[model samples]
Target: MATYGDLRWGVHLMKRILFLMSDTGGGHRSAAEAISDALKIRYGEANMQIELVDVFRACHWPLNKMPEFYPWIVNKSARAWGWGYRLANMRPIYSLNKRMIYYGNRQRLHNIIQNHAADVVISVHSVITPPMMYAYQSLSQRPPFITVVTDLVSTPRYWYDPRVDFTFLPTQKAYERGLRRGLEPERMRVVGLPVHPRFSALRERATVRAEHGWDDGLPVVMMVAGMDGMGRLYHTARAIDAQNLNCRLAIITGKNAALKARLEAQTWNQPTDVYGFVRDMADKMTAADMLVTKAGPATISEAFIAGLPVILSDRIPGQEDGNVTHVVENGAGVYAPTPAQVAETVAAWLADDGAQLRQRKANARRLANPSAVWQVADAIWEYAHAAYIPAPKKSSRSARYRILKPEATPQR
Candidate 1:
């Protein structure tokens, strides 16, 4: 009911902004938390309110309710989200999904909007976008529905309607892709990725390492790769020990207790620390000499935002190619194609020419738009209030990515 015109008087401490995130990837939750953190630091507790609802849990949707129903399909497919990442970025696949998902998620998004009474709603995942867009139809007054692309590349399916107030992108390519998808250039903001501001500030590496009880002078190699908690741990550990590299390694085995136990059993002569899951990634990043990670858009972007050099171990396919390009082109990181090659590259990176480090930092800084939250939050507020909310804009930046329609998939 109230539009930007109504907000001319400005908002007070009571105004509320709600964020919607998924449990699927650490990136989505991390992005939402980072924004919330920034808002709190800027406005303090009373001035801002944030609730991140997992849509699956918020509503007993069948597809979401029984994770076991399609266990093999679901888990395998999710792990294959990288293919989706690529498919979502490439061709007509990207464009069509935008419209399809937009319609499918309608009811759920409506319920979420109505229940939360959010002045503005932010979606960190694309699956929620379509539903959120349609949910607007059921409201007496819909809130501004904001979609933040949590990957290094822009998602075509996520940009179907220009009605969205703003689409936040991590890379220039993504911003351009959004424009090609029929978004107005003005509506596209090249705010790299939303990372905790703590990462933006330079932390004293020695202090962070000391607090973690790491050796005083060794190079700290932090692997940001996903853990299987199975055989992979020993292989990676053995590789490290055999290399006889002079570095302290820290491996984050996220949600993998088995891998943790297995790794603990190994008496690695090389100094190392293994963590299950860590909230203080920024600190760990600061303490590390160079990061070894998987090429997931969010992690890559976070590492980029932190200004730490990277060596991406596993490159998830599809859009991750673009994600990898962004980092490598900028000189902030290197992609190690072979598992064994990792140690050698680490050696080279430790002894890199001066300009390379400077360039990497420059590229990382260029990608980071640290003030993204204020801009995004403000845009959502403005759009949600308008009596006439626009339809989602087609992204123009996505023209190069338009793929053949699903109808054209060749029949075997």
Candidate 2:
């Protein structure tokens, strides 16, 4: 019943939203932008303001591998480091990762809380939540903090504490995972993934095609590599091209100069587009018939709402693999292991719209919950009212954190 303007906390003036993000993988930051855009569009600029920031860019990141450009690193040290990251993601390392992330960013985050006083604070990164919550306890004036998880696979690391006012989930499986983890069911909301509002317009396929100057019959295939402007694009493109599939290809080769150069080198007679880093992804999603990429939760969720069938491919190990599993198991995308297989599936979809595409599209519709933004905005409004006191009582310190395991557990 809480509409956008219905706030007892005088938040009908819900003036601003601070979207905290990082430059880690493009998915996290991109998810933040998507939600903020939704708030601005639904609430109107006069009623709301949105600001996006990169916590990592504020300081700069030391080189991290695999998920953050470590394809070669995963190849080089297959056993030592990559295995460690994957294995740690299991139930054992959850508490240890939680502590390391908390104390590391504790002070700097305290400053962020002191400086920006929005009605609500939202984070796309799970790692940042523990630290932010620790700092939130110190401020005399703090806003409600919500963690919008960009990953579909819920791990113990993500459900760190009960301090978060709400945790937004991407899938039914993730919601169930949260319930199993003892997260407060009232505070846990399954709003699907926060997708850009542009994807929510629900335009007819013919209407979308006319805007792009494409024939109504031609299937539009959009290829995206997160915001880094990347993913096994060349090979993926080559695989698609080899089929001479009847679909038009729109390749989004995000900021990677080498990837862009390689894509430019290829010659194709079919209708094709090769661009680097587009500011309006919702427009791109609106214009496409299908999405092809590694199954980042943000991209998958966006595609799900737009009713675009997805070809899930090119995943890194650990969380990305988990996300892809959720998408496939939920029937949101076709599980394609190779570029050729992806092309074959695309051909089947185009050959008979009733074939694979039809089923996947149904799955996507079943999977999407477009109301997540309003839910988040609603929670933020609540945060404004509840955050009248800046700090938690010291006597209640133990209430802030949950001990996942015993103290004698070994640290890696």
Best prediction by TM-score: 2
- Per-candidate TM equals 0.79, 0.81
Candidate 2 regions off by >4 Å? 1-16, 46-49, 57-84, 90-92, 154-156, 352-354, 395-412
Count of backbone collisions within predicted model 1? 39
List the lowest-lDDT window of 10 residues for candidate 1.
1-10
Candidate 2 clash pair list? 66-70, 140-390, 229-254
lDDT of 1 by residue, 1-412 (tens): 2212212223432345777766654667878888777767765656545678877555445536522332233335645765546666565775575556545554554456545655567888766676566556444335566778887763555543576777787767777777677888876787767777676675787788889987468877777554232113346555666777667888887767877777777776668888887778878877776777777776666666566677776564554567677778777788775557777776665555445555665666566665665565456545434433333344564233222212322221
Report each candidate's C-alpha RMSD, comma-separated, in the order given.
Answer: 9.9, 8.2
Per-structure clash totals for the candidates: 39, 3
For residues 1-412, write the lDDT of model 2, one tens digit per residue. Answer: 1122322223344454677776667777667766666666655656655666555444323412224544444434534544666665566576676556556655455445444545567888765666567666654435567888777774436544577777888767777787777788998877767766666666666665676676656678899877665456778888888888777898988777778887888898578878888776766777787899877777787787777778986665565667777777887787786878887877777886457777787788787777776676666655644524345654554343321212322221
